[model samples]
Structure formats: structure tokens, C-alpha cells
Target: MKIAVPVVDDSLRMAGNAGHTPYFAIFNLNGGMFKTFALEGLRANPKVVVGEDHHDHDEHHTCDHDEGDVEHIKAHDTMAGTIEDCDYLVVKMACKNTAKSMSNVGVKLQKYNGIETSASKVLSELASQFK
Candidate 1:
């Protein structure tokens, strides 16, 4: 089975929030061995600037939904693609929208207290559950 964990860094030492993680650590479980890879693209916190107001002119600049909305969609798409090949996803926290998306794609979501735990430790605990 394959498990994907959202990691805070490339070292995979910390678990990150599902929707906002910058990288995903994918671990493939084969017999007693494990192989892992890192996926990068998504941003944990994307800055969305609405607009800038100019005092000289009575004009307000604002971003159209076309730009912001498209980026949002693309981010989710990238995230989905990152974990598509995995059988399971482990996250410290996930929003309802993210959970719904995972469910739609048939990927099982596992919740864990990952704040104080490392990715390897969490994976080990999950493996023990199957045994």
C-alpha cells in the first residue's frame, strides 16, 4: 500500500496541514521495506491580495475572480494529482472541502495527532495498526 503524508519540510520530520502543506511525502509499503518520495507544488499559505487603494485618485484596484479563483482551483488540482497514486493520506488537519475531495477520489483519509510526531513515526504507527 502507499501512504502520503503532508510534510512541513523535505526532511519529513514534521506533519503539515493537508490543504496548506508545501510538500507531500509519499511512502510506498512493500513487504517490510518502504520507499519514499517528495512532491512539491502546493503552497501552505497563498497570499491573496484583493486590491490597492490610491489616495491621489478615487479608484480602487481589485483582482477579478478569474485570477484568484483559477489559482485556487489549480492548487487543489495539483494537490489531488500529488496524492492520486497513493492508497491513503494521513493529515494532522483537513478542512471539509479537502476531505470531500479526497473522498470523491476514493483515497482514504487518516487523521493523526501529527503536531508532536514525525512522519516516520506516524507511518510506523499506521503500519502497526494493519498488523
Candidate 2:
């Protein structure tokens, strides 16, 4: 089975739809140890942004949903895809909406928010439990 976690810079867990990386560590039940990382592509769905009218003076300022925004959306899409392939996702925190999306993909969401922990450490502890 595989477990996934969302983190920023390896430790900091992001809230809401902010930028974050999904750490997917795959485990080998037969060998009873970690096998490899299963997350290569996974991301969130697109967010519908309301742009200002063309007559607005700030129209040249660019809307929040620009090319950069598209890139961010792609990241989330990759995350969702990766989670869909996983058995479960251990998240410190996630947007309420995103959690629902995860659920729709048949990926269980496990929350770990009480104590500070790293993905590797958390995965190790979970692995020990399976033994």
C-alpha cells in the first residue's frame, strides 16, 4: 500500500489551496519495508476565478488566474492523480474542499496535526505498526 503527505520544504504543511508537494512513499508488505516513492504526477483541479471587467483600469494588472495560476492548478492536479493511485493520504492539513476531492478519488485522508513530524518519520512509525 501507499501513503501520501502534503508538505512544504519537507516540514511545513500548507493550509488551503496553497502550493505544496505530495510525498508518496510506497511500502512493500511482502518485504515489510519501504519500497519507493510512488508520487511522480498528481495535482488539484482548476479554480474558477472571476476576473475584473475589461473596462476596469486594472485589467492590465492581470487576473489571479493567469499562466502562473495555471501552473499552480497543474500541481494540484498532479497531487490528485497521485493520491488516486495511492491507498491513503496522511495530511497535516488540507482545504475542506480538497479533502472532499480526495475522498471522491477513493483515497482515505488521515490527519496528523497534534505534533510536529516529518513525512519520512511518520511513514516509519506507520510501517512499524504494520509489522
Number of the predicted model whose TM-score against the real structure is largest:
1
lDDT by residue (tens digit), candidate 2, 1-131? 66555543333333222213323333323343553333343243223222322121211232244345656555455556655766667655555445655777777776554354555555545554432
Clashes of each: 1, 10
lDDT per residue for candidate 1 within 1-131, as digits (tens), equals 77777765566754445765555677766564443333433323232211333121111222223434666656555566667767788876765555756776767888776445577778776664432
For all candidates in order, the CA lDDT equals 0.58, 0.46
| Model 1 alpha-carbon drift over 4 Å, by segment | 32-74, 114-116
What lDDT, from 0 to 1, does candidate 2 have?
0.46
Candidate 1 yields a Cα-based lDDT of 0.58
RMSD of each: 10.1, 10.7
